[model samples]
Target: MRVLVVEDHEELAETVAAGLRREGMAVDLALDGPTALERAEINGYDVVVLDRDLPGVHGDQVCRTLAAGGSRARVLMLTASGTVADRVAGL
Candidate 1:
């Protein structure tokens, strides 16, 4: 499966991508929201492992844009926040 790992945390992003790659999945990395969007446009991904907080653009906006643009990839949202609102907002 093709996966896109979007995260502003460099180490975390690389770590996640490496793990996915080890699982025999095709993986790509995006460090911020705009880059994520661009990569998603240029590549057809089966899943998007998206960080809920991102630079360049917000993750919520990124998700909305992807949906509005008809991207069929399923989004697996992640966040560092433990707040109820943040968790609910991700969905």
Candidate 2:
């Protein structure tokens, strides 16, 4: 499977990418929302591991753009916030 890891935390992103690579999945990294959108547009990703509080365009916008663009890749949003509202809003 091809996966894009969209995270602002460089170390964590690299680590996750490396682990996914080790598991035999093709992986790419994007540190911000804009870069993530660019890569997603250019690449055939099966999954997008997105960080909700991303810089540049914000994760919600990224997901919206992808959906609007008719992307087939599945998006999995990650966030530090654990509040009920945050979770509901993310959904």
Candidate 3:
């Protein structure tokens, strides 16, 4: 599967991408929200591993844009906040 790993943390992003690659999946890395959106626009990704608190556009906005643009890629949002409210809000 083709996956986009979007995280502001460079090391984490690279590590995730590397792990996905080792799993025999095609992976791309995006450090921030805007870059993630740009890459998503240019590439057909099966999944997007998105960081919720992104630098440029924010993960929710990125997901919204993708949905509005009719992208079929699945989005998995990650966040440091583990609160129930945060999880519900993200959903």
Candidate 4:
């Protein structure tokens, strides 16, 4: 499966990509929201792992924009902001 990881934390992004690669998945990394959105728009991915907070744009905005734009890839948000409101807001 091809996955796009959108994260501002460099080490965490690298770690996640490495782990996904070990699982035999194709992975691409984007450090912030604009790059993430651009990459997602151009590539057909199986899943998108997005951070809740980002630079250039917030991850929540990216998720909403992608959904609004009719992106078919599944999104699984990975964020440190673990709260009901935060999760709901991302959706």
Top lDDT hit: 2
lDDT of 1 at 22: 97
Encode model 4's per-residue lDDT on 1-91: one tens digit a residue.
9999999989999999999999999999999999998998899888999998899999889988889999999999888888899877866
Model 1, 5-55: lDDT tens digits are 999999999999999999999999999999999999999999999998899
Error of 3 at 35 (Å): 0.4
The runs of at least 3 residues in candidate 1 whose Cα sits more than 4 Å from the true structure, single-residue gaps closed, are none
TM-score of predicted structure 1: 0.97
Better of 3 and 4 by lDDT: 3
> For each candidate, what TM-score against the reference?
0.97, 0.98, 0.97, 0.93
In order of TM-score, best first, we have 2, 1, 3, 4
Question: Which of the two candidates, 1 or 2, achieves a greater TM-score against the reference?
Answer: 2
Clash pairs for candidate 4: none
The list of candidate 2 runs beyond 4 A from truth reads none
lDDT against the true structure, each candidate: 0.95, 0.96, 0.94, 0.92
Q: Residues 23-67, candidate 3: write the lDDT tens digits.
A: 999999999999999999999999999999999898999999999
Candidate 3 Cα errors over 4 Å, as ranges: none
Least well predicted 10-residue stretch by lDDT in candidate 3:
11-20
**Which one is best on TM-score?**
2
Give the C-alpha miss distance for residue 41 in model 1, angstroms. Answer: 0.6
